[model samples]
Target: MANARKKKRADIPARDRILEAATRLFTQRPFDEISAEDIAREAGVAHGLTFHYFGSKAKLYEEISQAAADRLDRIHLQATLAGSAPEKLRSFLVAHMEEVHRRRVDYVFHSRGGGTAAIQDIWERSRSHGIRLVLGFYGVTAPSLELAVATRAWLGYFDELVLAWVQGQITNKAAIVEMAFRLFPVAVANAELLGEKNLPSV
Candidate 1:
């Protein structure tokens, strides 16, 4: 039995085994209901080993979410078509939505209410990075104050809108993207009119 256990242990890398088990569990169960011991049992590892590697259940979930986001980021960065801001942003958004649609489990897990501080950190960082990406694509090296404010507001709105689309609360994804497209100018106009307070961070 000892030799059998050792041989089985050698069959899978520790972190990957733990992550695979956790991913399966996360897909089936709510985050709060899951425990480290449950993940250890599912991974066929010693209960303490989950803590040894991940420190906490929250951290494990954060790592899983981050890994999935990294994969999608790689896909989104791949330039399928080189063109102006609209063309590039549209291609990027299409790729992003497709990746999120494919990884609906991770998308739902990351987006909804059951989020930790670690997850919130990821979202905050993503918001900043998204603004930078848009500014680069639009060739706006020195964005005005209104443009920055509007972009921030647009990102906040876009995240919620995409969440609704993912949850099937909104059926028209094209409309979601279409609205996003129209809102760029609207956000700017509102920022100009309302002194950067109208569309204030969704």
Candidate 2:
């Protein structure tokens, strides 16, 4: 029995196994509810191996988020820049929601305890990238702090609206997309920072 277990463990590389297990487990459950032991068990590795490779459960969770983010970046980076700013943003958002749904890892708002920082850091990085994407979509050739800040604020609001959509609190994706298209003017009116030229019209 012991020899059989050892042979099975030798079949796959430990790091890959741990990462695969982490991806599966993390995608299925909220971050805090799962333990390193659980991932180790699922990966068919010794419990200590998870620690040996990832250093901590939080680090393991971060690895999963990093993987998902990288994949999302690769898949949507160009598609989000394809059309007029309004058309681009709408396409980008639809792609984002579909990716999130496929990954089954919308655990950002659900993370608790020690994983909060990891999840939030990923969120901020993702948000900043998104703001830049909108700028690019609009052909904002020269960036300014005021416009950037206004756009960042808009992304925050847009994300919350999407979250509501995700939770079945709001079922209208078109409404979300429509409101998102209107956010630039709203941001301009509220912030008075971005000039008419700096904002998207449609």
Candidate 3:
């Protein structure tokens, strides 16, 4: 078993191993508490390799943050276009909740990323993608300012709901998803009231 484990580790690429180790450490502790040497030791690679592969610890952390954001974007992009807008929204939410739950540690870490600009940018970009998806469900590509603001506000609410769930403040995923879905029409209605016009049926 030991020999097989060693062989399996050897077969894995060094850069990937380092990244895996770094992710585990970063998620477990503040980024400032982890060092390149610590990542190398955890990855069972030479210390210099950490810098060689990633340039610096901060760069490595940024890469991890970007990767997490990209995964969420891809998942949102996979929402089917064939369903009714409400059905599509529910599918997006289900995909989102499952992905977040599967990587709750990473999700929580990047979601609250210690006030770093790079991480904040990543989070904002992911949120923007989500807003686009929600708007697309209503077939609105050129939303008015009021509509855009309303949609973003709704996204913010959903963000807090997921954050609460991941932090264990909320135990019912279905309830959170349904709540968000139920509020969608209200968001659109408010936008319409605010002078946005002709939003496609949801």
Candidate 4:
């Protein structure tokens, strides 16, 4: 039984080795430039095993993107569950920026053109989950149409803000956090006006 378990554990490293090689290759060059053969050579695995494990390069890219998105989702969920709207928002921004900094390579890959359709879908879903959590924390519940519009606008704003920060247009993380903090009250007020049906008492 112990030998069997050891054998299973040994296989996990090969999978991770492929992923690591792919990640490094993707970061160093354009997605089109990196071939499965390159990845197999870098990972020290048979080329066939790359296809066997990940099906295709596109699929492997999707898996990497999904993993990163999942990490971000977990961070946001943890922050939300820890405190009130204001606190949650602060923690969420901090955690998000920190994650981006830590996983900058993955961020770069997603920001680039390497993402597969499945990866794009997972990212969109994760974003929606974050926005919904924020709305819920603020006790906001508008009509479905209005909520959709507002959420879209808010997400666009959030995306722009993060992109600017990532591109070095914004240097101070604390300043960005402060700006986010200031925006929360206005958002909450707007929610109060638009979402009368589900306003929680202060």
Ranking by lDDT: 3, 1, 2, 4
Q: Against the true structure, candidate 1 has what lDDT?
A: 0.74
Q: Output the better candidate (2/4) by TM-score.
A: 2
Whole-structure CA lDDT of model 4:
0.72
Model 3, runs deviating above 4 Å: 27-33, 113-115
The candidate scoring highest on lDDT is 3
Which of candidates 1 and 3 is the stronger one according to lDDT? 3
**Per-residue lDDT of candidate 2, residues 1-202 (tens digit):** 9999888777889999999988888777767678888998999889999889889988877777777777777556867746666777778877776776665444443322235576678856776777777777766655577777887877777767776776678899888878877776677455444453445443
Position 82, candidate 4: lDDT: 69
RMSD of 4: 4.8
In model 3, the Cα lDDT at residue 111 comes to 67
- The Cα local distance difference test for each model comes to 0.74, 0.72, 0.83, 0.72
Runs of candidate 4 exceeding 4 Å displacement = 1-13, 23-33, 108-114, 140-143, 188-202
TM-score-best of 2 and 3: 3
Residues 41-151, model 1: lDDT tens digits: 999889988888999888899998777666666675675347877777777667767776766655676666567877877756765666766766756666667778778
Q: What order do you get sorting by TM-score, best first?
A: 3, 2, 1, 4
